[model samples]
Target chain A: EAGVAQSPRYKIIEKRQSVAFWCNPISGHATLYWYQQILGQGPKLLIQFQNNGVVDDSQLPKDRFSAERLKGVDSTLKIQPAKLEDSAVYLCASSSTGGGGETQYFGPGTRLLVL
Target chain B: AQSVSQHNHHVILSEAASLELGCNYSYGGTVNLFWYVQYPGQHLQLLLKYFSGDPLVKGIKGFEAEFIKSKFSFNLRKPSVQWSDTAEYFCAVNAFRGNTPLVFGKGTRLSVIA
Candidate 1:
């Protein structure tokens, strides 16, 4: 089966600029997630969607970050007025269900460099 | 909030050496443990997971992990290391209830020399 897909493997923008990353989960996966992985750190959850509704997003920096999975298959993460701290690899993952033990398949990720 | 800790930031080993990476999580309730590996220029991939039934779970590529509930630890192990095993390994945890997202550790970078 094909894996999850992400666009524009890399991006560079100045601080305060706006940027967006896109993700397309594997066919039939019901759960999708977005994570931010900074240099030397592990992936941190930004948001999670079960179908079109959000399941968790407590860690998201709502002041500048937003994500939507409107048709239940694809997702977009936006960082408005980006900051230097926002420079990280944005990863997307999906699983067949919302179960905690379910295996999540990840995309190659979008590497963003906010200057 | 749940949190994960990986003891080693980096490790260097020779081929055919043994490997063990320590990971611990802080959470009072039941949880599901996972170890994900990212090779150079590759996306994160599951090395193994532990839910229940067994404390020791074997995964792909001769990797395995032992989940010790008493210690809140799930350490990854490989009996014999290879250069191909060099990568970044992350430990993550999520509530067993299935509503929470995985909390990840800082990750450990392993370098295996031939």
Candidate 2:
């Protein structure tokens, strides 16, 4: 089976510029997630979508970051006026039911470098 | 809120050496624990998970982790490591009841030299 897929494995943008990352989850998966991994740290969940509806986004910085899963299959994460701190890898993951103990499969991730 | 802690930032060892990586989590209620590994140039993958029953859990690639409820710890271990075992390992946790997002700790990097 194919795993989660993400676009633009690497990206570079200037500070204050806008950038967007795309994710296509595994077929038939019911839950999708976006995470940010800064250097030397584990991936932190930015948002979660269960069939196009948001399940959690409490940690997301609404002032600068936004994400949507249209039609519940593909999702997009956007960052406006990107800050130097935004330089990190953005990962996408998917699971069947997202229930407790369910394993999540991750994508290759998009590495963003904000200058 | 829940949080996870990995005791080691980096570890190096020769091939065939024993391995152990420590992890601790803070959550009063029942929770699920997971260990994920990311090889070089690869995406993150599950090394193993612990939910209930049998504190000892075996996972892919001869990896295993023991869940200690009282201590609130889940440490990954391997009897003998190989060069391919070199990777970044992350520990994560979430509530056992709800559909909660995972809380991960700062990862531990392992280097196995041949």
Candidate 3:
């Protein structure tokens, strides 16, 4: 079985530019999540989707960040008009279910640098 | 709000030395604790986890953590560490029973010198 997959292991964008990251969860997984990990900090949850429907996005910055899981399998996270503070590692993770002790499998993550 | 805290930002030790890393969480409700290790150039992998039952949980690579409910602490430990054990260790917590986001610590970088 393949693990969660993400594209563009690294990205560099100028300030005010736009960037997008993609993720594909493991087969049969129902929960997908997007997290932002700033340097010297832990991963912070940005959004979560359960079968194409959002379960939580309270921490997401609506003005510049957006994410969608259209088919409930693959997901896309976008940042429009990026800012210098947006530089961080975008990590995508997925779990097989919504139960206790559910281990989340993470992708390699896409490191972004905004100049 | 739930949050995780790892006090040790970095630690160094010689080969065969014992290791202990401190971790704590804010919420008092039901929780599932986990420790993840990220080797150089590698993605994060589960070191171990604690849900219910035995507070002392053992994980792969000879790592172990003890969950103290009263103290609200879960600390990672290893005996006779090797240089291979050098990596960034993260402590995370899922406060709710299901489908809840994990709150992670800043992580502790362990440097085991041979």
Local error of candidate 3 at B96, Å? 4.1
Model 1, range B56-110, lDDT digits (tens) per residue? 9999999999999899999999999999999999999998976677889999999
How well does each candidate superpose onto the true structure, as a TM-score? 0.98, 0.99, 0.98
lDDT of 3: 0.93
Best by DockQ: 2
lDDT of 1 by residue, A14-92 (tens): 9999999999999999999999999999999999999999998988999999999999999999999899999999999
Among incorrect, acceptable, medium and high, the docking class of model 2 is: high
- Predictions' DockQ, in order: 0.87, 0.88, 0.71
Clashing pairs in 1: none
Chain B TM (all candidates): 0.98, 0.98, 0.97
Alpha-carbon lDDT, every model: 0.95, 0.96, 0.93
Task: List ranges where model 3 is wrong by over 4 Å.
Answer: none
Q: Quickly count the clashes in candidate 1.
A: 0
Q: Give a tens-digit lDDT track for model 2, residues A55-85.
A: 9999999999999998999999999989999
Model 3 per-residue lDDT at A59: 97
RMSD of 2: 0.6
Worst 10 residues of 1 chain A by lDDT: A96-105
